[model samples]
Target: MELIDSAARAQQALEGELGGERMILNMGPSHPSTHGVLRIVLELDGEEIVNAWPDIGYLHRGDEKIAENMTYTQFIPYTDRLDYLAPLANNVAYAYAVEKLCGIDVPPRCKYIRVICTELARISSHLLGIGCFGMDVGAMTVFLYTFKEREKIYDLAECISGARFTTSYTRIGGLANDMPPEFLPMLRKFLNELPATIDEVDKLLTRNKIFVERCRGIGVISKEDAIDLGLTGPNLRGSGVEWDIRKAHPYGGYENFQFDVPVGTAGDCYDRYLCRMEEMRQSIRILQQAADQMPDGPWNAPEAKIVLPEKKAVLTKMEELIHHFINVTQGINAPPGEVYFSAENPKGELGFYIVSKGGGAPHRLKIRSPSFVNLQAIPVMAKGHLVSDMVAILASLDFVMGECDR
Candidate 1:
């Protein structure tokens, strides 16, 4: 049969079976159930969905266009706003791009620090994303429990970078600052305690009959479909694909880390949730290794012209004054080149493509936002699922509006 004929016959059969009683529902643009500003137009027959169309761009900020006008250093802060749940991942992505463009290699110590901060960011993102999903699904206690741990991670972030949500601590060559004395000890504590917390959360939701029934079979996307649609992170892993950017590309010395990329056999909300939970444990393991094997050295890449001068040096030395003045006033001029850098961001493959025209500012900068691409799968996955499951699927996808619209 012709494709159009087959589709028409299927529609005819469906409509005849339902007696033309189909209802349309708008999921959100402002609905509290949606984690961010997203709208899904659903065509339903009673409780079962017939089709779903996702309407996006409700949180568009034009961040990529703004980056073209801003200098490389100035653009770093904007990256933080993308995946606010994992701001450090945004920092790493943008910094990785600039570093690649300028051919800058970070010191071993700086790399370890980067790993620690990025992993913490990953854990923080999963905490909020999964925790909120629990609340959306009527498990309010899970939300509170998740946030309790998330807050601890955020506190650790603040201790390290002086900010929680919008930490632009990563600079082009390396980081904006060095790790403090107390940061490691606190992180070690968190690392030690995290497994137990994860166990509690797992026991709370993973095995509950109600939670399983709601999640186990809904929103199933096959591995081929996931890859074809450019899905990454836990969503793809839930579909049984073992492709992780940290392992596949290994930027920022992720190659040194020994960890497992957990995959789920069934591509469903439950599988995605399980993937994230396992990911948090893996991130903690990475952090423990990083903290243990951390090297002692300057955190910033040792380039006086590109890197900012120390305040003490600027005060004490006249030559330092000249370098500082040139760096801040004129800004760092990257060579005429373009580079694309991708990292294993919390959301997925957060990547930045930077084009430098051998000037103080970038000629063009584009972000390959994971949330934006990950959200694309919604229309496909959400179609034909119940309206209530729409919320579950949305939470499972974990789309951050800032990154999507940016």
Candidate 2:
């Protein structure tokens, strides 16, 4: 009886506030278009949305709490699950954070390789994002075109990390292994072919009257609102803000690469979509420069204490065997300090904050996932828009629930 009375009171409060005129609609916790178990409770007046409240946490795995129980190196694979679309980027970001906490500097060659990996991840992520966005808005051909290109990138990732989807390739000091001999040749071939494909995609949707009408001026966000909401990545750039972590922070030799940061004028769904398309071209440019300036040197840092010994050395030498055993069993000893590191991920800024008490594992770990942050803008963008326009807005933000709900 008490439970029923509480439910009655809650319903009365909800309906009374809107004067019983607004209808409550639950968009999804499992709908295909919500993108990943995201539920949005929308207050609606006919076709117009009065308010939208996003409900998350369906996919929560307590990743931050889990980090406290695992070694720093042991946590890399978990980052892969955060932004499953760009696992390599997440790997780099988390590794860099641990490296920063430990005061480990990876070699120059390692930095360049990391840059290449991150850019490739960015390109792959954006291709899928754009393709899916197009499909959401009823353009089927773009999905086919983008997936063909994405598969080639997956091949490259597999060559580097031996796994395509969850490439836990980065270590605190460097990568698990250096790029294969054949990797560069395949990368060059893909670079040469990708530009023409991008142009084809551009021509297909950029000027289409139907596409433009559906996207442009829908779900617009101004620069001020975007900044206040802490939006980042292409979503922030799409709002005509010229802020990119690569340009502003310059991590992992990104400063050495020459590329342009694309900005939009209208700050709408169309502009966000355009920002992602142009970003792919910029990623290609960065990749070309990284490939040309590729240096040959040690892949890992010279710190033997932090980096694992080679497997061959561990098998042949007693000293190497002990080093490997100790490092594997105990993990790298991080200094007692706190550090925050963020990378320009496909969605936005993927940041990791670590606090260490001079141990192999973190005292506390926090992940500032971009999808979680960027999803905050949905309510701001969705209000005052028709129900049909909500899909375009959600796609423009390019969020993954894996990251958002983490």
Whose lDDT is greatest here? 2
lDDT of 2 at 229: 98
Clash pairs of candidate 1? none
Candidate 2, position 183, lDDT: 94
List candidate 1 stretches off by more than 4 Å.
1-18
Evaluated against the true structure, the overall lDDT of model 2 is 0.91
Which parts of model 2 have CA positions greater than 4 angstroms off?
1-20
lDDT of each: 0.87, 0.91
Clashing pairs for predicted structure model 2, backbone only:
none
